[model samples]
Target: MRSSDVSAGLAEGAGQAAAERIRDAAILRYGRDGFAVGLRAVGADAGVTAGLVLHYFGSKEGLRRACDAYVLSVIRSEKLKATTGGPAVVIAQLAEVEEYAPIALYALRSLQAGGELAIEFMEQMCADALEYLEAGVAQGLLKPSRDPVARARYLATQAMGSLLLWVSLHPEFHEIDDFRKELRQLWDEIALPALELFSEGLFVDRTMLDEYLMYVCDPPAGDAKP
Candidate 1:
C-alpha cells in the first residue's frame, strides 16, 4: 500500500510454478488495490524481489507485456466472443463489460505517457484497425476518401482522452475500480454508432460527431443519464 511498494514482476529464473505463482500474486494485489495497474507494486505484493521480477520480465515494460497477455487470457477465459457487428460492435461489446476498465485505464495512461510497451500495444491495435478501416472503405462501407490512419489516430486520441477524463472526474471508480464495464458500454455501445457514422456519407455530419466528441472530451458529463 505504501509508495515503497513500487517494484517489478517476478525475477528471471524460476520454474513455471514460481512464475505462475508470482503472476497470481500480482493479479490478487491488483484486484485488492481495486485494479491499480503497477508492475512494481504487483511484484512487491507478490513477495518477490524487484530484481527477481525484473529478471523474469526484463523491465517494467516487459511486465506490462505479460500483464497485457494475462488480460487477454481473462478475456478468453471469460469467453469474450468477438461481436458479429464489425469494429463498432466488437468495441461496444468490449466497452459494455465492467471488467475491462482497469486494464483499459492502465493501458491508456501508459500509452499517453509514451511507455514503450504501451506504445507497442497501441501500435499493433491501430495497425489492425487500419486494416479494417481500409477494407471498409474499399468495400464501400466507408468513404473512399477516408484515411484509415487518420481515423485510427482520432479513435486513439478519443479513447485515451476518455480514459483520462474518467480518471479525473470519477475517483470513486478508482476507489472501487472496475469502471471498465460501464465505461466500455458507453464507449463501445453508445459511441460506436457515431464511429460507424464516420463512413463516407456520414462523415459530413460534423454536428453529431462534435456532440459525441464533446462527451468523450469531458468527464463531468459522464454523470449524465444519456
Candidate 2:
C-alpha cells in the first residue's frame, strides 16, 4: 500500500529483473525477525551488496514496503480471492488458510508501530474490506439500510481482534479443539451482532476507498519505471 512506485505487483516486477529474488529474500528475512532490520543484513542474506538492495528498492523503507506489497498481493490474489458472496463469505474463504493469522499478526504489529509506511498498508486493508462491503450493497448481497464504511470497520475490528486473541491465548488451553470452538463462538456470537448493524447501514468515501484499494489490489497495470 505504500505508494511511491514501490507498489506491489507488476510495478515491483519492473525493477532490473532480479526483483523477484530480492522480494523472496525479504520474505525470508522479515517473516521471522526482531528490531528494525538493516539493509546490509538483508543483502548479506540475499548474497548481494547492500547498495544493490538499495539500488533496486530505493531505501530500506522502500524494500520493506515492497515486501508488504508482495505479501498483500499474495493475500488478495490467493487466499482472499473473491468467491461470490458477502463479507462473512469472504472471511470464511480466508479462514481456510490458517497461515494468514501469523502473517497478519506481524502486519498488525507493524501498523501499530510503524509510521507512514504502516499507515499506508492499514489504509489499503481498510479499503479492501470497505470495497467488499460496497460490492455487497451493490449486488444487494447485503442489506441496503446501513453505513458501509462503519460496517467494514466493525468487521475489521472484530476479525482482527478475534485473530489476535485466539493466536495469543489458544496455546494456554489444554484442548486445542476447545480453543478453536471458543474462537468460532466468538466469531458467531460477537461478529454476527456487529454485522447485523452493518446490514442496516454502512458507507465509506468512494474516492478514498478506490485509491486505497487500487494501491493494495494492484489493478491490472501502469507505474513509473526506471
Best by TM-score: 2
lDDT per residue as tens, model 2, 124-213? 766667766556556655544235566666765666666656655644533334444554555566555665654453454357755865
> What shift in Å separates residue 18 of candidate 2 from its native position after superposition?
2.3
Off by over 4 Å in 2: 1-17, 77-96, 99-105, 165-226
Cα lDDT of all candidates, in order?
Answer: 0.55, 0.59
Where is the poorest 10-residue window by lDDT in model 1?
Answer: 217-226
Would you estimate the TM-scores of all the predictions? 0.53, 0.56
* lDDT by residue (tens digit), candidate 1, 82-201: 312356655656555666555565454455456566567666656555555556555544453334476766765675676667666766644324564447556655555664554334
Clashes within 3 Å, all models in order: 19, 11
Q: Indicate the TM-score of model 2.
A: 0.56
Lowest summed lDDT over 10 consecutive residues: which window, candidate 2?
Answer: 217-226
